[model samples]
Target: MERPIDFSRDRRMLCGICAHQWLVDLEWIDRWEQSREVCPGCGTTCEHENAPRVTVDPDDLALDDDKIAQLAWYHTSTLPDWPTRDFDPAADLTPETRRMMGGSKRVAAWAARQRGKALHVGTYESAIHNMLRRMRDQADHGSQFYLYRVLLMPSVVVREGWLIDPGNFVGDVVLDEVCPPGVDVARYLNYHEDPGGLSLALGRGAVAGVQQVAVPLRDACNNDWVREAVADLDGASDALVPATGRLGRFMRPSSPRAFLGRELGAALAGKLPVNLQDQFASAAAFDEGDNPMRWARRTSCLFDLIVVPLRALAELDRQERRTV
Candidate 1:
């Protein structure tokens, strides 16, 4: 059994030069104060005295069954028939079929291999981001998208180290365990080969009963506004440095889809100014009224199952027609 470390005591440190952030235990910070340490992000020797440090409060790190029940979680997909409530990671795919799967299916299989069998869900923003990402990558010209609002059972056991600073949690690595001596870290640490840690919770029954409601967005991928925004973002991202050699088969170490989703989400939220802001205006308004963020914020934990009424679905279709 792994020993539980108190995350409330962890201190978040940021590297001034690279802007890389990481979480370290109190002991690690104490040692760093005595002697400067090498930054994992940029390999620069950072002086502890000048580095930014913030200790996490106990309340901020608190997660329990009650808290899990209170918050809404979500998952998004382009596949209309994709399983929502009872997710079997291995499902119908065999080893051969798993290898043959492409796009999100392939990613899902890979996640199951890395993180074991559990339904993956996150905050409302994450769900919207995921939907946009799928539309940008996998959706057809007339493809629709589904947004699922997931309700976790009050008895759900959420894994620790995931709720706060998830990027650091996911990116945490032991060089010796993952990379062989004299081998390039980039070669092994890219998306395809990295050993993920989510299995620590998923494989242990962290999720029990789950209920979900699917909201269909018709012709979402075909919306002219969405197309313009996606095109603009894709062009910008493609100009960045590309991965080389064998690793090119996978993807960038930095997950570009997530980055694009965040950028697009921010743009939609009016938090960022983009060249296509005018084009995205109508879509942004539609998003504001009928989005995962709004739904997640409005509902309470009392409802065991929530479904969108037919009138609401009609309203969504009407909204889409107006936006388009």
Candidate 2:
């Protein structure tokens, strides 16, 4: 079977007339070689060579050299070769990491300043959770190790945004037959229950011949997904909350009272007080207890912050639909 085109990762040809880059999705390259496709950017029908614009490479969109140098400084200043080390919980952040972190806090703010678009690029935590979920869907048909990793690692990542290809990232084997009827999708979606089955499905994929490749943590900040987002914003604005703890800090209330309305906060917090003083006065205070509900509320707050801005953007589309 032919590989499907990934709009996010695949390169697209640039049209000479309008300078718009478009992916070739529906037809074969050989067929395209014989007959050109229409340029989506401009209504120009031209051969690939006559188009005058080359495909845009995702790698070129990586973080600029200065940003990379900054990360390198952080990496070298703290550890001799921090980029090579696997993420470890017991490790301490070097001054460089702290500085990189400070920069991350500005992503959302910067994103907001963009002219007409707003996006929540999300923290590494969200990315990792997304990856784990992806792994649950794609990993070997029955790997116990992968199962525990998916279940336990949601809250444990030291950093995130490492580029791991979801397609080739894991799997010793596909155990489609081993999965009970109707149980496959449910296992991962409703993972709070029997994730073991998902793990079991993934276990076969963890075999010796299977290899999982991951882009370095240092490059996580430079991933194509983020760079493309920034580019699409067209210098409008942006901010970043690099981690969940800082995400909580960014959502913290300024005054003694809870900004999130007493009732809503109380409800989200379960029986716990909805006071900002307790929840976001400081990092230490918020991390004080292992109360799962407290963590859930924090996660919910972050999720809401990530989504509320997009509501207006969605509204714009709705208005356009009505006009059309």
Candidate 3:
């Protein structure tokens, strides 16, 4: 049609993952052909229908000064060449923000205390993943509110205020008939190139493959461990004899459990004597923030730690059994 864009206005890019608006080169649209669109930096393919086309006059609310400062610090640290963080609308922090930033680098200091270290904001891909929080969702659809993760990677987190985008910068969501029916709604993902026109089908194949191996392994670990615990409990007098032997062998395309796979199997095989000893002690041993061992019950951690290993071992064993 009419190029679906307005040439008279300034250009900006709103990353669905980081939610940070970076300036777009107006010359880009002029340079590229009418038939296609792709990210200027990465050869990542963005289809014709997916580019932002509309802009309106700015009626932005009073910007949050502290948030703007952090954005500046992030720019200085991550993408040094990007524009500085000072709000175009204002020269300095709001009076209330001056109180929050404490006349010095309060935001940065506070961030270090909370996160222990400044988050190492690196490549665009990593930034996108850290913000969205959601891994590639395979079965989600038709969600109006897309969660784009904004990781405050800079050494400062504004505790007393929130980022305000009063102007409500507008962009277009490019969707086309070529995209496949089911697409993961993870904002950070710049939808993949699928044959059937499913625009956001990127990395779904890997997610699917992991699930296939993880599912059976997770189930078998839980089942096998529970069987042992129950048998022990039922006959308190007898030593815990597992109702079934270990997951004999599992075959997987890749080793998903390189770090904890063998260790988990060894733990499960050894007798911990009482159910009082958490079956998931192994997972807890490596617990960090969002400790799955603590948050998820012992049954779950046990299952999580054991699944990949058990799946690989079990798969191998199954094929061997078939041979016999």
Candidate 4:
């Protein structure tokens, strides 16, 4: 089990040279309260001005059963005829589509189980948080998206090369945040509305040639129904990233006949890379009522599940390097 750490009782500091920001544990709070601390990214005794006061704690993290239900509903939208309830066996699932969902119904079943529980908000939050950690652990072994892609389409990702692109062959893309490494999912989910933390958890580096694009919800199509469904199974709250109405809008109302589907086709056809930053820009331009930053956060969380495999890959690389 992963131990819970205190995010509060700390100050966040930024390295001016590397633009790397990190949290300084409370142990150093008084020692450096009057001065700056050495940065991990770039070794420098950052000045006091470079550090800012911020608070992050378990109380800050929120995930509940209702949001989980809505997310599960979104996942149901990804399927053609799956029952959109708390739990589904997917008995109606077609073999062709089943293969696309990584050939495992465990994730869907897991979501159902989570939803079925009558746990308190904190309980749900802690459960989901731990699940995310476990998912991260599994990703390191290349068991996430890479494994599924290989099983379904063996010739997609390049076996070996300096220029590694995960979605090169079919736009084989995965949804990811545009925010730099070190920004915690909480910060992003919260839209960085707070004063900002002193320290950020560094991001696992992305693969070379792998592009992080954000497709506007209006332009995004449900290419792989199963993949989208699976993603929805482990979704966060729309309220957490309150910008757009709901994260589901980005890929719902299946576009089986739209010309737009040609570009954003199912996970298998992966073609065009959506520019998330630009998509948010355009949405903000016309969404006279919604907050663009909030919309970005919602969008980020909506697609957060899609990047697990990539994150796993990054973690594995970090581990291998440590051993070397």
Error of 3 at 152 (Å): 19
How many times do residue backbones clash in model 2?
A: 34
Residue-by-residue lDDT tens digits, candidate 2, 55-154: 4244431122222111100000112221221323223656576466565455434433321111111112222233323323434112111101111111
Which residue segments of model 3 deviate by more than 4 Å?
Answer: 1-105, 112-222, 234-324
Tell me the whole-model lDDT of each prediction, alpha carbons only.
0.38, 0.27, 0.27, 0.28
Model 3, 155: alpha-carbon shift in Å? 26
Error of 3 at 166 (Å): 41
**Candidate with maximal TM-score:** 1
lDDT of 3 by residue, 1-324 (tens): 001111123345443333334444434533433435555444333343444432212321112323322321100012221112221222345768756667546755653343321112122222222222112232111111111112232232222221111111221222221122343211111211100010111111211111011211233344454555434333333222233335523432222222233334345534322211232233223212222222223334333323333333334334311100
Q: Each model's RMSD to truth, in Å? A: 15.8, 24.7, 23.1, 21.6
Name model 2 segments beyond 4 Å from true: 1-19, 22-39, 42-63, 71-324
**Residue-wise lDDT of candidate 4 within 202-282, one digit each (tens)?**
111211111112112223323444344334422422232322466665743332222222222233212112212222222
Pairs clashing within candidate 1: none
Per-model TM against the reference:
0.35, 0.19, 0.18, 0.19
Query: What lDDT score is found at residue 321 in candidate 2?
Result: 15
Alpha-carbon runs more than 4 Å astray in model 4: 1-85, 89-92, 99-279, 285-324
